[model samples]
Target: EEASKIVTPNNQSQLEINGGTYATDSWTNVTPKILTHLGMNKHLQQDHPLSIIRQRIVNYFYAAYRNQRGNPLFSVYDKLNPVVTVQQNFDNLLIPSDHVSRQKSDCYYINEQHLLRAHTTAHQVELISGGLDNFLVVGEVYRRDEIDSTHYPVFHQADAVRLVTKDKLFERNPGLELFEETWTGSIANPKRILPSSKFMDQTKQPCHTLEAVKLMEHEMKHVLVGLTKDLFGPRIKYRWVDTYFPFTQPSWELEIYFKDNWLEVLGCGIMRHEILQHAGVHQSIGYAFGLGLERLAMILFDIPDIRLFWSNDSGFLSQFSEQDLQKLTKYKPISHYPQCTNDLSFWLPPDVEVNEGFSPNDFYDLVRSVAGDVVEQISLVDKFKHPKTGKSSVCFRIVYRHMERTMTQAEVNEIHKNIADASVEQFNVQIR
Candidate 1:
C-alpha cells in the first residue's frame, strides 16, 4: 500500500530520459530505501550492531561467512549448489510428469516454470557428478503446508551427500585415515578419491542386514555426534530411530534427547537411483540425508518455536550461548572407529496416528520426544505388503549408541521399551 502511494521521483527521473513522466516526489537516493527496510524489520534494528561502511563486528560476520564457505564441513557453502532459493527447480533430478509429488497438495507448482521445493534432496542431485564423491549442503527450503507446533510452510534443511560404492557404506575404509585436519582436528578425505569397490559389488548386498546397516548407520550418526561433541565439549544423550522419506530406500531419522524428552534432529538414507541419474552421477553408490534445520536450532538452543530462527529478534539471536558459539568454533579429535548398522522392520497399520489429535509425524515425534537418547538412528527399510496381517507394513532400521560408553543389549532394550510404549499408548501402533 505504501509503495504505490509513495511515488519515486528518483526512479521517475531515470525514466524521464526514456520518455516517462517525472513523479511529484521520490527519495532521490536509494540508500534510504535499504535503511528503511532494515529499520522496518520486526526487531532487527533493535540492539543490532550498527551498520556502517566498515566495522570490526561486520568484518567478523563477513569473515565468518567466507571461512564457513571455504570449509568443506560447511556443506551450505557447496560451490556446485551455489545456495539457491527453495522454490527454484533443481537443475537435473529427473521429474516424472505424472509423479504424485507434482500435485499441488504434495508440492507447490507456480505456473509452468516454478514450484516450492518439497525437499533438499536436490542438493544431493546438484552436487554429485560421476567423478566426485562426498559433500553436504545447508539452506532454507519452502513447502506449502499448514503451520502448527511442528509443521511450517518455510523451513531450513541440511542435505548431506556422499558418493561411494555401496560397499563403502558397510566396511571401514583404511584410507579414511587422511582426515586429520577436518573439523574434528582429524584428517578426513585428504583427497576426494573414493574406494572403487563401493558401487559394483559391495552395495548390492542389503544394508538391511544387522551387520551391514550398522556400519552405514554409524558413519551417518557420527556426522552429527561428532559435530555435537566438538561443540559441546563432552557427552550428550542421543539415538536414532526408523523414519520415513521418499528419497532414501533405507532411510533413518537421527534424534537427540533433550530436556527430559527425545527430539528428532536429522534424516538419513541411501540415495535412490533416479536421484543419482538426475545429478548425472553414474557408477557410484550414494548415501544421502536431509532434515529441517529449524528443528536442529531448536534442539541445540532449546528454542520452542520453529519460527524463532527467523524471528529477526536480536534478543532471540543474542540468546545463543557463548558455549554454543564455542561449540560452533571449537575443534575435536576425528573419530576413526568403524560404524555398525542394523535393520529391523515391524508390522504397522498405515492408519496409525501418534496421538489422539495429532498426525503421523506428530506421533513419530512424540516417540522421539520420549526415546531420542537411546536410538542413535532410524530408517525405513521396507514398506507396502504386510506378510502376516496383510495390512501395510512399514519397516524401520534402528541404530543405537552412547557417547559416554558403548551400549549393552539390556540397556538398549530398556530405551527401546520407552519408544515402544510411546508407539503403543499414544498411537496404538505396533512394532514387529
Candidate 2:
C-alpha cells in the first residue's frame, strides 16, 4: 500500500493552481505531470545556472543603452501571469485556428479559451497594448514537447521585443558598436522572412518603412549575435538558420556548435504588423526573439541532459555559485545506472482509427503518470495499418532508468506490469 502510494502522487493531489476557477472539463491536455511543473521556476533560484544566464543576458541589455535616452534598452517582465487566454497565446499572435501549434498535442489547454503559455511571446500583444515599447519577458513556458536529452514539458524562455517608431528610426542609425562584421548574409541576400502556407490571413503587413525595417533587423541580429558570443565566448562557432513562427516574419534561429552538433538556442524575426496594430502600436518597426535557457545552459555548463536541471541532487546543484555568472563548470556524472527497455504494441480503437483522436502526448502523459521521471524516453518504434481489419497498429519503446541508482530487474518488471495494465484500463488500448 505504501509503495503504491509512493508511485501515485497525482491521485491524491488534484487541486488547481491559484488565480482561476476551472470547470471540471476545462483542461484537455494538462495532466498532473505537467501541472506539477506549474510552480517550479528553475530560473528563480539564486544558485541556478538558468537564473545566472538570464542575468548575464539582462546585464548586456542594460549596459548597452545605459547612457542613452529611454535608457535600460530593455525592461524585464519576469512576473507576468503564466495562464493566458487563447486569444493572447494563439489568436493575438496571428496563429490560424487550424494551426498545428494550437493543437492539444503541442499546447497545454486549460480549456478551449485558456491555457498555460507555450511561449513567453504570449505576453507580447498585452504588453504593447498596455503601452510598453522596448522590453524583455522571461517566464516559465509549457509545451507538450517530446521527451529527449534536450527537451522537457516545462522550460524557461526569455522573450525580447524592441520597437522603434518611424521617428525614432529616423533619429537612430542602424550602426551599433557591438555589431562586428560577423553577419552571414550580405546586403543583397538578407534573411528571408517567408510566410507559412498554413496561415490563412495576411502574410506581409508593412508596419514600418522598408529602411526602418532593415535597420531594426540589423540591430536585432547584432544584439543576438553579441549576446551569444558573450555567453559562449568568441571561439564558439554558430550560424543562423531560416525558420517559421506564426508571430514573426522571416524568422531565423541561432544555433551554436556544441558537442559535435548544432544546438538551436533562440528564434527571432521581425514582428508581424498586424500583431502590433492589434496592440494599438502602429507605424513602428520592431524585432522579437524567444530563447530556450535550458539549451543555452546545457552547452555552457557542459551538462549532458535536460533532466539534471530539475534534479535535487546536491552533487548537481552545489557545483555552481550564484554570484559568479561567468563560471563555466563541467558537470561530473554521479551515477552510471543501467537503463531498462520495454516495448508495448497495441491496435488503435475505432475512435482513434476514424477520428485520429490519439496523440503521442496522451501516451507520454500516461507513462509519466505511472513512472514519473524514471521513464526517460518514449519513442514510436513502429506503426502500420492493417488492410484486413482496417485498424492501425503501433509499437512504443519506453526507456526506463533511475538517474541516481540502479534498479533491480524485479522492480522494473513490477513497474512494467503497472504500465501495461494502465494502457489497457485507462487508454482502452488493445495490448498485444
How accurate locally is residue 397 in candidate 1, as Cα lDDT from 0 to 100?
A: 61
**Per-residue lDDT of candidate 1, residues 1-432 (tens digit):** 222222122334332211222232321221111112211322123321111101221222233323334643223332222222222343343333444555544443322333334566665554565344655454445444433445544455656676555444534544332112222322223233322312322222232333434455566566556654543346777776765444554566777767788877677776555456555654455567765655554444444444343445444445433332333321121222222344444445565322223333433343344543334455555666555656555555666654334566776666566656555554445667
Q: lDDT score of model 2?
A: 0.76
The lDDT per prediction is 0.44, 0.76
| Model 1 misplaced stretches (Cα beyond 4 Å) | 1-101, 165-215, 228-235, 277-280, 321-324, 327-432
Model 1 lowest lDDT segment of ten:
48-57
Cα RMSD (angstroms) for every candidate in the order listed: 19.5, 6.6
Task: Kindly report which residue pairs in candidate 2 clash with one another.
Answer: 193-250
